[model samples]
Structure formats: structure tokens, C-alpha cells
Target: MEFGTTSRTSGKPGPRRERSPGGSDYAVLSRQVQEAGLLRRRPVRGVVLLVVTAAMLAGSWWLFVAVGDSWWQLAVALPMAFAFTQCGFRGHEAGHRQTFHSKRLNNAAGLVFGNLFVGLGFGWWMNKHNRHHAHPNQVGRDPDIESGALVFDGDDAPGRTGAGAFVTRHQAGLFFPMLLLEGWNLHVASVRALRSRHTGAPAPAAVEALLLLVHAAAYFGALALVLSPLKALVFVLVQQGLFGLYLGASFAPNHKGMEMLSRDERLDFLRSQVLTSRNVRGGPATDFLLGGLNHQIEHHLFPSMPTSALPRAKPLVRAHCGDLGLPYTETGLIDSYRQALGHLHAAGAPLRAGG
Candidate 1:
């Protein structure tokens, strides 16, 4: 059997040329992966990561509180923000059922790590993220690409008017700065989702809301006890800003600047996942920083695969895509960001001209 051929299953040379909005090829890929036994959970690894991230968060918090001066506190808060980001990734994995075999355990962990500790609504995030994986970069379907401030596809371009025009014109330059508000935006969205009647289980939503309130109270109370009001405010801004920037920067390269399919455009699962996803070229440090998101193609294809297994899956996926004549994009982190920014600039050009 050739590297990318579907012959193993279908006795065919490769995937069919026809596109499938329902991701028909996904059934073939899933069968292959199941036979290869890549769907198993690594409970020990997940628990270890949880413990390490929790310790890091606790240590960073302690340092922040112990620092006598505001400047030193800010310095300590940087690590705290990074720790929070790691916890966020862990929560993401939990949401995907990648961390544990038991759905109940995974949900419990997601609630604690995502909702209580990180102040993100686990249920809300899962709902949004699952949609993203299902239809990445699809103009109308993928919420991640539907930002009002930043135009991705031509359909999202703003009409010439007001703040929309201003934002559309300067979105490329403002991308990084705008990300500084992403943390706050996520928290606000979480609260709104919890409050909305349409977000499913009222009991779970209320519990998540209560957890967020507790997180806010504990976070603000600790800051107030340890620092002056002004310093505390500054600390909050710096920490949340960094958290947002880090999170956004880490994720932006995955699909941004890649192909954008129309909502109605149909594509096989493999092509849809690979064409829109970009892999970061790096070593262990990159893996650690991106939380295995560097292998976005594989992650999208097999959302339930453990983070630790992503690297191992990469070569196989790349080879498969290669044989299928699919585009397999891999670039340095800095280069990927540059490409994303360039795409944004290009997308906004019409709005600027109209303005």
C-alpha cells in the first residue's frame, strides 16, 4: 500500500475527488485510526500535567502575593498568566475527552479547570470549539473566523461606516493589541452564555456562573489584600492582557491565512482539516508552548487523540496528505504570524478602499 492511498480500506488508489460537507472521508480516516489504536486515553499523563500546572499556578500566585513592590508583583504575575494558559489547554483537552476515558471524569475535570479555575465556561467553549473543528475557516459556519473587527473572508468585510470602517481599515495593525482584550471578552462571553436560556442545562450553567463568581471574588480579594488598589488594577490588566495575547497568538496560526471555504462549499474531512490548518516548525519548546497545537491538522482530524500523541501522528498524517496531493503547510511560528497578518491586511483592503 502507498503512503496516502486509501487502498487499505477501500482498495482504491486514494480518496475520491468529490467533496463532502459531511466529511465522508472522515469515516475512512476514523477506521484507520481505530485499527491503529490511537484513540486510547493516557490517564497517567493527563493527571501528571494537571498536577504540574496546578503547582505552577499556586507557585506563581504565591510569588505574586509575596512580592513587596508593585513592579515585582507584575513580574510574578507574568508566570501566573502562563500557568493559567496551560490550565486552559488542559481544560480544552478535557473538553475533547482526550484526557480521560470516562466522560464523567472528563466533564468534572473540565468544569474544575476551565470553569472554576480559569473562569471560562467549559460547556460554552466546547460548543463553540466543536463547531470550529467541524468546519474550520468556513466563512459563515466557523465562529472563530467571524470576527467583526477583523475581516477573514470577503463576506465578513464591513460596510463603510463608523467604528466598523475604522476597525476594518486598521485590523491588521491592531490584531495583537486587540488580542489584549480577548481574555476579558472570553469571560464576558462565558457569563453571557451562562445567563442565556438557550445554553442547555440550567443547573450546570448556574454552577458554572457561581464558579466564575467565586473565581472573581478570590482573585480580586487576594489582590486587594496584597497590593494597593491602583497596583491591583494594574496587576489585573497586565495579567489578563498577557493571558489573552498568549492564548490568541498561540491559536491564530492554526487556521488564519489558510484557505477559507464558503459555508456551502463541500470538502472531504482530510482536505478540510489539512488545507485550513498550518503546522508550526519547531522542537520541544514549541510543543510545550503550543500545548501540542503545533500539529493542528492531526488535532483537528482526531480531536480525541492525546496531546502527547500528536507529534507522533504528524509524520503519518503529513505523508498521507502528501500521497493524496493535499497541501501540508508547515512554517516557523514567526512566519506563520506574518502570513496571518498579511491575510488580514489583504482581506480588509476592500473596506479601506470603500472607506
Candidate 2:
């Protein structure tokens, strides 16, 4: 048999054509984000979360008042713990454009959430977090995690060493105390934020400084007038500590060590996001507590989409990935945490702030 021209349809390249701007494929799965439930969009609906948070804050305030005795104030601020956590949640939703459709409302909530408590910085977090969504596993870019400092093999980020490493190695003892002083982990990025352009604007920075100052002055001023200093300290401790744990866990589990992109790690941004990010599957508890963050793939793809609608979109993502044969990792909440721990253990060095 003699070989002749093969059929083009049989795995042959088609005729080439001119490409359009950005050279991106026209097909896209993106949907314009909608508020969780429209028609209820307003200051009133915004309170849906604050309603829960308010009750908790009020109860904590009342309890702190009722018990001005020995160690009891420390024992009873549990409701306030929820309030602080919700404070983070409301701000997180604002960042995602899921809390309320109104940019002003969300920004206000985020600003308060940022500076409302002891250690939060809304401006810094919004920058890093939004970048994380854009870059996912891009090694040089994703600050959602500090992959530590030293790089091992191709993927491992071996951590800091020497005295700092020694401290990180023995970090457990310091966890509670550091958590206490820092106002949860809210202040974690504020210092770095100060030197950057984002923090350069005198207006926002002054606002940030004032918020921190007022945050301090108000609590201390309130303490001097009414409660004992020791009791006020305790209030800060419990709320900050619990909220810190929530903050760390909420973020770390999403993409601790899936696959990191290098400075040279070349990938299409959209593809990399799908490759590195995973879902927590879903459940009622995940929905309420996580504000539907468990829908990681859907969240990354359609970030502006209200978190509640992620469920509606999950299958669409899974289907697309299924077609592409790309890895789309998912696990339960506990399992994801376990995976983060595993990533840490494999790194086996001390954690650095930007690792």
C-alpha cells in the first residue's frame, strides 16, 4: 500500500488562523457574580451576619461586666470568641464580594473588620489574599502562604534556621502568648504593609493608625473606667487566640503544598489555579462556618460570585476538570488540615514568616 495525504480530521492539525487579543480562548466559564440573594441587598441584609456577631459581642460585653471577679471574666468570654471570628468572616466575605453587593458597605465592613479588633489589617490582607487567588500555586507569587524560605528539591520550601529557626522549631510554647499580644494574627502583615505603596497614602494609613490607636485606647480607656486591667487583658487573650487559630486554619488548608509555581514556573494562570486549588467537597457545617469557602475551585474560578452559589457551580468546575484530566484535589476539613500538617512535616524546618 502506498501512503498518500492523510485525512485532516484524523489527528491532523487544522488550518491556522489569526488569533485575537491576549490570545486567550473565547470559551470561558465565568459568570457575573451576584449577591447571595439579591432583592435583599442593602444595609439590612448585611446585618444577617452581624446579627449573629452582635449577639455574641453583646453577651461577651455583659458577661465581662457581670463578673468582675477573680478569673471568671476569662472563663466566660466564649460568646465573644464567636463574635471575633465573625468579624473575620464578614471581612473575608467583603473581600470576596460575597458579603454584600455594595462596594461601600463591604469596604466599610472590611475596614472595621481590619481595624475593629486588636490585630487585623484590612488593607494588607486584601492585597495578599486577592493575589493568592490570582496566582494559586505560582511559587514566586502566592503569598497566601509563606512557603518558608529555603527551597528543597523542586517543590519543598525548607524553612528558616539558626536562632529564628530554633524559635520556630519550639513555637508551640509561644503560640498563646504571641497570639495574645498581637491581637490575634490580624497585625501579622500590618508592619510590612506600612512600607509599601498601599500603606503610603497618609489618609488610609492614618485611618489604620487611628483605628489601632482607638482600638487600644477604647479598650484601655474602657478598662480604666470600669473593669480591671487584668480582666481586660483576659478578654483580649481569649478572643485573639481563638480568632488567630481560626484565621490560620481558614487559609493554610487551601493550598499549603499542592504544587508551587516557580519564578520560572510557567503555566497559564487560569490553568494553574485549577491545578493547585482544591475543594473541601461540601456539608451544612462547612457552608455556615466557612462561609462556603470549601468550594475552592468554584470560588477561584468565579471569585466575585457569592459563596452560597458555589454549590450551584461545583459540578460545572468538576466537569470541566474532568474533561481536561487536570488534578483537582478535594478532601474533608479535617483531612485538608492533616494535609497541611503533612506539608509542614515534609518541609521539616522551622516556619519563616514568608516561607
Candidate 3:
């Protein structure tokens, strides 16, 4: 481990747990939590995500609007902010599909939110995310967990010769811009994938292209017609930049590095959920900014469960972990963010050709 990082084995005094809910105990664990009578109900979570999304939209609009004619820059900025949240919210449920009982309804909602904010939609994401979850530490196949794929290797094999060595060391910082302009990155990736004839390019790539153009036109043209150019651009910057940064950061923290255990090591969903992730407890700010993504372990275990209920539900996870002797790691927000940055920085360590 790097400086300021400690292994679960070395930390504390008691025996720590690593495994999650097993087959036979699954029912017992659920029964324990359910019997507590504190389990968060479903639709309540859906309603809450929607409510927060609405409040963000409303607050941004009302605040800038209150400023009157002097501040058109904000006009474009605020709605895009909301749009970003809407995108995240959609994916949140799609990942778990716990928000709605109907898979079709969840997928439809995910597609609308994702495309509106330039995401890959539920179907496309599932392909990537599912593989990632299944083989999280595999160097090439795990698209979900970013296990140093962009980072360079110090000790290279004969095949990774020449410039590939230098490229690895510099990838971390270089990747920041891509994270910032992820919407563009997503489009570009889609283009390349389509051109290379990758499976599931959403049929004929041209439709995707046209879809992109139409989305751009609708957002820009509407802003131009209704608001001014200045506000429209600011809106894009705020929502596009901050929203991307936050969402991407949330992802980065979840699985940057805990253990490079193989998919086989992850014998079950619960084990994968706990070993592959950690969380932050940022108090009230967590609810506002992250939608309580601070509870990633709990979220992964009960993916179908809604976000609003995560904080409340996390205790159950902690209790279960305690019983199982799991090393439930919890760091403050700043520390957690620092850990993610360190992961990126470490991944970019430079190396020479092995061959």
C-alpha cells in the first residue's frame, strides 16, 4: 500500500471480516434486518430521488431568475446542473433496477435520463458495468472497476515495449481532462467502437450520431431562443463540468484499490460488494452532494435498493459486517477523495520497454 494507506490486516486489534453474506446465511441476514423493522420501503426511495432532483432544478432556476436581467450566464448553467443530476439519478436506479419493479420501465427511464445528459443509457452501461462487477480486477476485461487500465506498468513484459512504457506513467494526470469532458469522451468512445464494429453499437451508428446532433441542437437552440448565449454556455460548463467530476469521482472511489482479487475470489455478490469497495461518511453534505453514494458497500449489496435510503440502510450493512468479522472501512470525505487521487497518480508511474 502507499503512504497514508493501511491494510485491513494491520489495522485495529480484532479479527476483521472479508467475506459477505453467503448462500445459507443470506436468508437469515435478510431476516435479521427485516425483523429490525427498519428496512426502507421502495417507492419512498424513488419519490425521494425525484424530489431531490426537482429541488435542485427549482433552486437553481429560482435563484438565477431572482437575479433578473443582469445574470443570463446563470440561466444556461442551472438547468444543466439539474440535467446532470437527472442523468446520475437515472443510472442509479438502472444499476439496481430496484427503484421500479418493471425492468422495462426502469430501462426506459434510464435511457431518457442518460441520453438527455449524454450517458450511454441503461442497456449500454449494463454491458460494461456487469462485466466490471463480475471481473473487477481483471486487467483487460473489467470495464466496471477501473483497476489501473490507463496506468503504466513499471516492470513490463516483453510485449509491452517502447512508448507504451512512457504512456503508462503519464496516464493519470492526462485522464483528468477526459473525466472532465466525459460527455465528449463517451461520444468519441461510441464512435470508435462503432467504427471498429464492436458488438452492440446500437445499430448503424448513424442514428447515434444524429441523436447526438439532435440533442445538441435541442439544448443549444432552446437556450438561444429562450435565454442568451452567455447563460447557455455557463449552464453547460457548470452542469457538464461539476456533474461529470462528481459522478466520476464517486465511481473512482468505489473500486480504485482494495484488493486485486480475481472474479473467482468474488464467489458471491456480497463478497464482491464488500471487498471491492469502500465509502465516505460526509455527514449532511453526503446527502446533498453525493446522494449518499457514501454507502457504496451497502449500495452494491442491495443494488436494487434506492439511494435515499442508503444512509439509514448502511447501519444494517455495518452490523452484518461486524457479525461476519469484515473489515468495514470508513473514511472521511476528504481522505476518501485523496485516496482516489493517489490511485490515479500511482497508476501513471513511468516505465521503459520490457522487450
Candidate 4:
């Protein structure tokens, strides 16, 4: 949804004020959030969530193993995928050091939940995510907006030839289906990153690589034991496809279609985050489904703040943005997706024309 970018006083537009690109706006907001105690870690909440997610994972696996019918196993895959996504979210929180005060503990959790269980590379994800957070929608710098199957901007659109031209012409319509492959894409990317010298710490990356191997072995071995080869293949496709779709659906709305900053743009932290981030409008159900990511604006503003506390920080952040005449975009989930798709279609226009 659109939000005003002009100052309001007494229900009327005030004199326009220009903010310096690198002003102290973010610093002031950070101090306010810190003084209000929103930055404190919530270990108990983190522990409870961890325990509950583990139990759910165990239960789903048990159901998958115990059920003989392919249909029942397929049904079980739904919860299994959901549980896996939740574990991935936990890993995300740990990666941000929001789940634990101790860096070592957080790293341990990130490795276990992200690398071993979810098949994501913790170190690789951390480095990439940090860059995204540092430059949310920056054209050249933000890896999230970098050239991919679905280009985010016309300038980054693919060459007008072969699959690139075909996909760019239909990216908006193909976006959701493409997301079905995201799980596999992420797995390959993680493996490549771990193997690359640029990822740092060869020994640790090797250990993570081994753990991923173990996870794959256990995952396929369990499925093979429970079902025929064909069924096992189907199960893998269903589970991973759902996992990727859920992940992409939940994350795409956070920033897509809002704003695209130039590579050399110098924006204050507050303006950069609020303008780029879009919040999803919902309550508890949204929180559970999105892993409290519905409050994208707040999360972007305070990356280390616990997810549990994001909802509480939302109104405060919204009000502050309103007072400062900053953009605070929030929209329903379906509308957000539509906006994202629309943005993609518009971005691909130049490529389609060139072809």
C-alpha cells in the first residue's frame, strides 16, 4: 500500500523539509528503541520456540516413517516442510545473534539448525544476509536484488537470447513456479559458497559441508526405507517444493516493489530501511506463518531485536516514521504479491522490447 512521504501537522501538509542524506535520523531512532528496552534478548522465548519446533519436526518425521500409504506420507510431508521452514527461521534468528547473548552459542545453534537440519550454509548465509541488510534495495550492492531468474530492475535484466530472453519475458507469471526450485537452488548455492575460498575458515566450511552430506544421507535414507523409489522421489519433490514456495512467498513481500536505491545513493539508515521495507498486515496467524517477518520495517530497523518483540516494536516504529514524514508501507499479503509481480513485469519490459 502507498504511504505519504510528506510532513503532516494538524491534519494538513506542513512546510516541506529536506533531510540530509547522511543525517542522524537513524541514530535518534536507534537510541529511542534502545532506551525503550526493545533491544534486550529474550532467551526464554527462544528456548521455548526451539523446543516446540524440535518436537514438531520429530512428530512429523515419525508420521512419515510410520505411515505405509503414499497418500499419508504425502500428507505428512506438509508438516515436515512447515517444521523445516520454522527451523530455518530459528537459524535466521540465531545468525543475527538474537536468540542468545553468547556468540558461540548462537553460532552453534545456527550451524545445527541451518547447516545440518535445513541444509543452508550458516557462514555463507550470514555474509550474504549482512550485505543485504547493509544495503536493502541498493541496485549494485544488494545481493538480494542482483541478477537472477527474475530480474528486479531493467538495468539488471538478462541478455536478449535463449532462456534469458524467454524467462525475462515471462518472469512475472513464472515467479511462483520458479520459487518451487528455490530449495534446490539454495542447496547448490550453499555448497558452492562453502567450497569457495572467499567464504573464509576452510576447516569450519569443511565441517559444514560434511554435515550437509550427513543431512542429505539421512533425509534420503529415511524416505527410501519408508517408501518405494518412485514414492520417495515424489516425496522429496513435494516437500522441497513446498519449503521453497513458502520461503519465497514470505520473504518476497518484505521489500519488493517499494523502492530501488541507486548504487551510489547515500541514505540515512531510517530512510533506507523504511522506504525499502514493506510490512504485511496481520495478527498472530501472520506472525506464525511469516516467522514474525510481517513486521519487516521493525526487523530491518533493528536487525538484532528478537522476533518475538518485533510486533511490540511495530507501532513505535510506525509512529516514529509518521512523525518524521518517512514512508511506512504496509499491505495485505495478496496485494503485496501482486505488487511484486507487477514490479517484475515492468522491469522485464525493456528486455522483452529488445527481443
Candidate 5:
């Protein structure tokens, strides 16, 4: 019945320990958090953020056009990338229903920010994200960790050959550079998902497709209209590349290198969320850059909780985890990335050995 008997002072997770699987621990903590009103929706704050992000996106475009057909336009693409990624963050919050009290309102915002503004599919992303939340880092369940260009699971590492093997063998070094293409990959994936949808596509899916088309038209049309051919091509490359890099950097630190669950491994809600998530310690700037995702443990514990409330919820969750002897991992931003990359490097070790 006693937890926390083991040491976790190093901030690295030790071997998995046997513990009770009852849900009462989480229920009690949830009730405590609810009493503190940490779970309440902060509509005004979310709306202000959404509005500011939209303004930023518009301003970036305005600068893009005003700067005219010059190499200096690449300078404008920098902020455009940041603005686009912020819009993606807003869509992420909406998908979690953290931005609005009403589910319909949240989905509406999600569709706009995700499909219309960011050219991402809200439905597809939400489905994938929800599965991740339900079973983060689980071998067969979490799509985020699924074997692909980068293998997170050791078992999936050895069989890769040719380009896949070369990439896998040096993934830790290649990770950030590879993120440059993530924006293009997301767009292609979203379009593919929409095209491959079953017959009698739902109204929402149809709406997503239309918004994406509009986004494509406006995004490409504006660049081509304002910039010369070479400039426009460079602008697209710069903006999309940095956008993906920004998003990937913000997200990579949260759960990578943390403990992963095998298919059959089980934990209660509290343990499953808190143990697998790593919080990055920083001030307001970090929160802004990461879109409040630095509080990963708290966010995972309360997915519906507003972004503004995650900081307030952090102490409460940490104390609760402390009381229960659970490992609450947190690190500096740079350190978090290091841990993640270290995991990738370790995962690819077997392939290196074979070569």
C-alpha cells in the first residue's frame, strides 16, 4: 500500500515497481484539483490568445507582401513560421477541449485554427491525440511512439535496412534536421487522410477538406502574387521548415526518453500520466514558446484544464505525486531535449552494433 519507498531523486525513473491498480488515488486527487477550481475553463484568456495568434499570422503575411520581392523576405518568413506554429498550438488546445466550455465551440475553433489557418486536419489529429492521451508511450497504442522514420521502441529498431537503417542508426543526430520537413509531411498526411476517408464522408470531414483547400489557395496564392518565382519558393521553404522545427522542438521534450509501457503493462490514471510525462522548468517565455506544454505532467493529468491553469495545477500535482511516492520528472528545457535525444540514440544502438 505504501508508495514512494523507492528513490527518484535523480529525476530518472527507476525500475517499475509493483503498485495497486485502484483508481481511488486519482479520484481523490481529481476531487482536490476540482475543489481548487483549477479545472474550470478560462474562456477569456483562451480567446485573447486565439485572437493574438490570428493577428500575428495576419501581420506576418502583411509583412511578407510589404517587403516585396527581395531576399530579405526570408526574414518575414521567420515570424510567419512562429505564428503558424502558435496557431497549431491553439488548435491543439481546442482539440483537447481546453480552450472553450462548449465542445461545439472548441471543435469550431479547432477546425478554423487547424484546417483553415494551419492546414491540419482537426478530426484526424484529435483521433490520434486522444489515443496518445489514453495510452501514452505504450508499445502498441501511442501513435506518437509508433515505429516509422524514427523508432522509439527498441524492438522496432533492428530490422530496418537501407535508407531506413541509415536514418535509424543516426536518428539522434538527424532528429532536428528531419523536423524541417515535418510541416510538409503534415500537410501531405492531412490531405491523404481526407482523400482516403470512407464513402459518405461526414459533414465535419467535408468542412475540414474545404478549409484546407482554402488555406492552400490563400497561402500559395499570396506568396506567388507578391513574390518573384525564386523568392516565393524560398519563402515556402523557409516558413514551412521553421514552422515544423518550432513545433517539433516544443513537443519533443514532453514524453520522449520517459518510461514507456509495454502492451500489457498497466497503471492507474495518476501513475500512467504523471510517470510518463516530463515537465520542463521555465518562466513565462518558456510557457509562451512551448504553448504551456512545459507543464506536461499537469497537462496530461488534466487534459481539459485550461493552459493558463497548468502552472497553478503544477504544485498541487507535484505534491500529490510526492505524497504517493511517484516519480515526478522535471528538467531544464535544454536538458529535456538532451534526455529525449539520448533516448533516441540508445534505441538505435542495436542497429549501430549490427553495422
Candidate 6:
């Protein structure tokens, strides 16, 4: 698969990852990032983001109502779906505590953006995402890499039979198509998590449940009111399908093709973040579309950094990685997808070959 300019650490292994005596190398880089003021919180950006999202939601709803029971409501669903994913991105930032200084405020923002806006559980996503960040690409520890519907690790690719084998063998071809259902899957997972007594929801289960119910009511109730049953059904399919596809596509490029660390693979914090994640090269449009996730390496290293600040932090992080002789992967958007899909195809090769 094609990639942009990468260091010695890209296709080839770089220096061995041994912790330096006295302290971790991450400390040195962390100090530089912090001193550059990249760690500072900027609430104005958060406020502006919230306002714009709210306006988009409001405008879309108005258009839905204005259309007044027509096939065109499906058109309205397009922007609405995009708006929902934007809300999801904001909730993700809140979960990382990147939007606010106070933990309570961040949690509150997460609830509003997640359960209230996107109908996803903030707590459930936070729990899942935090694990991913802590152990990105780790086969067992990172939930993102754990095999289920799709087998990510080669170790889990063999011995499949029947449907599982067929799916595993064709997973690369099916990946993007499968993402069309991811929106529904996320909703189901959230509801299931909220129902369990041991749900890791940060808010009271009652509160989370209530907000989800409200969102569902408002969302479907409005759709039902404005469109015929068939039209509403079509609209829901279009909106949710596009939502899932958009969200999945935005996230898939970050680390899918990168190295998957085994439990025994030891890496310092800096290396772990840089080595596993990838960056996407583009202009401001890329930043907006990915919600600043295109800068995956910088975001993973300094998750608390504001999204707007990721561009500013990129050069510093890249320079430091260069100094440390670490791999810093950056690719065009299309090429990133190619790398990820190529990895999936390669992982599934054994199944295709009669294993």
C-alpha cells in the first residue's frame, strides 16, 4: 500500500525500544509539548463548536419540517446524519477532557453531545475508547483489535468454518459495506450497556437512560409526524447508514494498518503512541471532515490538547519523533484506506488459502 514520506521506522524497524535509565523518554517530549502551551485548554473553541452544531441540527430539523411529508425528507436526512456524527465527534473530545478543564463539565458536555444529540451512551463510549487509547493496537489489551465480527489479528484468522470463514476471507472487501450497519450496532451496544447493572456509565444510569429515551422520542417522533411510515423508514435507513459509514471511515485510517503489539511487546509511552497511530495529510477540509482525527498521532500523544491545536502540535511531535528515530506515519486519505484495507486482506489470507 502507498504511504507518504515516512522515517526509517516505517517499513523497516528502527532502534530497539529500551527505556533509558533514570526516566522515561516520554518525559522529555511531554515537557516540550507542555512548554509549547499545547496542553492549555481553550474553551472558546468548544463553545463555538457547540453553537455551530446546534445551529446545524436546528436548521436540519427546520428543513425536515418545512418539507412536510415528501420523498425529499430523505435529502434532509443526509445533513442530519452528518450533524449527528459531528455531535459524536464533540462527545468524543469531551470524553477525552479536551474541551474543558473540569471533569464534571466534560462529563456533562459528553452526556449532552452523546446521549442527547447522537443517541449514544457517553459512559459506554468513554469506557471503550479509554481502553483503546491506553493500549492502542495491542492484540489482547486493546479492545479495538479484539476479534469479533472482523478478525484483526492474524492469530485469530485461522480455523474458521462456514459463514465465519467466508466472512473472514472476504472481510477486506466487506469492511466498508459492513460499516453501514455500525450506527445501528453502536446504538444497540449503548442500550445494552445502559441496561446492565454494572454499566460503566459515568452519569447515573437513570440519567443516561432518560436522555436516550428523550433523544429517541424526539428523533423518531418528529420523523413519524412529518413523513409517511414508508418515507420515515427510508429516511432512517439513509440517515443511520450514512452516519455509520461516515463515522467508521473517519476512524478506520488512524491505526488499522499499523503494528499490532502483542502483550509481550514492551514500548515506552511515546513510542507506543507514535508507532501505532497514523496521520493523514490534507488541508483544513481534512481536519474539519475528520474532526481533527486526521492528526491521530498528535491526538494520541496529547489527547487533552484541543482539536484546533493539533495542527500546531504536528511539527513539534514529528520533529521529536525524527530526533528519537521513531516512525511517524502520514499518508493521503485514500492511501491510508488502501493501507488499512491491504492489512485486512493480508490478515485474511490464511482463511482464503484453505486454512
lDDT (tens digit, per residue) of candidate 4 on 1-355: 1234422111123222356456677777778888889999999888898889888888888888778647667788789889888888888899888999998888888888888888878888888888999999888899999987778877666565678878988999999999999989889899998766454432387788988898889898898788998888888999999899888888999988777777886666777788788999999999999998889999999999999889888878888888886768899999999988888887888777876
Q: Give all candidate RMSDs, comma-separated.
A: 5.8, 8.5, 5.7, 4.5, 3.1, 3.5
Q: What is the lDDT for 286 in model 1?
A: 93
Instruction: Judging by TM-score, tell me the better candidate of 1 and 3.
Output: 1
lDDT tens per residue, model 1, 256-289: 8877776787777777788778999988899999
Better-scoring candidate (TM-score), 1 or 6: 6
Query: Which tens-of-lDDT digit does each residue in 10-125 have in candidate 5?
Result: 23435445455568788878998999999899899999999999999999988988888899998998999999999999999998889888888998898889899989887778
Candidate 3 lDDT, 1-355, residue by residue in tens = 2334443222313223234335544555566656754344476566566567656655665655465444555554646554566556556665567567777666655555555445444345555676765665544557654433354222222233356444455555655555667655554554454444446433345554555566667656655655566765666565566556656766666666554443333345555457667888777666556655677777766666666667777787888777765657788776776765565455443342221
Q: Comparing candidate 2 with candidate 3, which one achieves the higher lDDT? A: 2
TM-score of 3: 0.73
Please give me the total number of clashing residue pairs in predicted model 5. 1
How many clashes (backbone atoms < 3 Å, residues ≥3 apart in a chain or on different chains) does model 2 have? Answer: 6
Candidate 4, residue 226: the lDDT equals: 80
Over 4 Å off, model 6: 1-15, 197-200
lDDT (C-alpha, whole model) for all candidates: 0.81, 0.59, 0.56, 0.82, 0.87, 0.86
Q: Which ten residues in a row have the lowest lDDT in candidate 2?
A: 7-16
- Candidate 5 Cα lDDT to native: 0.87
List TM-score per model, in order: 0.91, 0.76, 0.73, 0.92, 0.94, 0.94
lDDT pick, better of 4 and 5 = 5
Using TM-score as the measure, name the better of candidate 3 and candidate 6. Answer: 6
Instruction: Give a tens-digit lDDT track for model 2, residues 134-221.
Output: 7776656776545333232123433355764544543434433443444434565675575664632323776766776676686567
Task: Give the lDDT ranking, best first.
Answer: 5, 6, 4, 1, 2, 3
Which pairs clash in model 1?
none
Model 6: colliding residue pairs: none
Model 6's TM-score against the true structure: 0.94
